[model samples]
Target: MKEFVWAVSIICILLVFGVVLLKYLSENKKYKNSSYGKQSQKSFWKIISNQGARGEYRTSQIIDKAPFKNKMLFNCYIPNRSGDKTEIDMIMLCQKGIYVIENKNYSGWIFGNEKSKNWCETLKGKKYFFYNPIKQNRTTV
Candidate 1:
């Protein structure tokens, strides 16, 4: 009878420990998922604000304009400094050589010259300066 009692106590202790461990693991997973969800939402908004969809359309236009062999590919990736990082917009692997292109879409009255450090966009005569996409694309290429 005493041996049976000891076995029952051991089993009860093990059950309690298992329950605590399971709770901890579940809480950790919930926390991780919430943080990841927040990050993904932020990234999605950034993409929309940056007009990434318009850029893709512009890239398609550039691909159509370029003359290359039928087999040459467009939108091929070029490796950047990082192993997983790539500066991919439009690429054509042709008999000439590899060509890298970056596309930008701006929907306002462009109000700056080439000599200007910052280019301004005038929408209804309200001017706002934006980052120079030419410099950015040069670096991206």
Candidate 2:
């Protein structure tokens, strides 16, 4: 009878743990779907910095360490005919032609094709839309 009682206690404990885990996951999912998750992080630096900026910063850091650092420009802006400014992430002036480079920093499971106008990503049941960088960059290039 004592052994049976212990088994019952163990099962109850495991079931409680499982329930708690499920609740945590569900709460997390809800949080992600909420505006709190959708809202961009509010910080003094966050205002000036972002994922794309961070990615470009990382790229610059790498280029700064490279052997050919003198041939690249970072965050170069060009004015379009429409009086709008187009920001190029990185530009490599080569003998052949000026190469326009675009960078994107992303996490989670990315789901999109090369031709898709919009790319989608799923992170813990949340979905995000990002414009196709290739297509977007082609206009400036």
What is the total number of backbone clashes in candidate 2? 0
Model 1 alpha-carbon drift over 4 Å, by segment = 1-50, 65-67, 70-86, 113-116
Candidate closest to the true structure, highest TM-score: 2
TM-score of each: 0.43, 0.55
For each candidate, the alpha-carbon lDDT, in order, equals 0.56, 0.68
Error of 2 at 115 (Å): 1.5
Per-candidate clashes come to 0, 0
What TM-score does candidate 2 reach?
A: 0.55
Tell me how far the alpha carbon of residue 39 in candidate 2 is from the true structure, in angstroms, after superposition.
Answer: 30
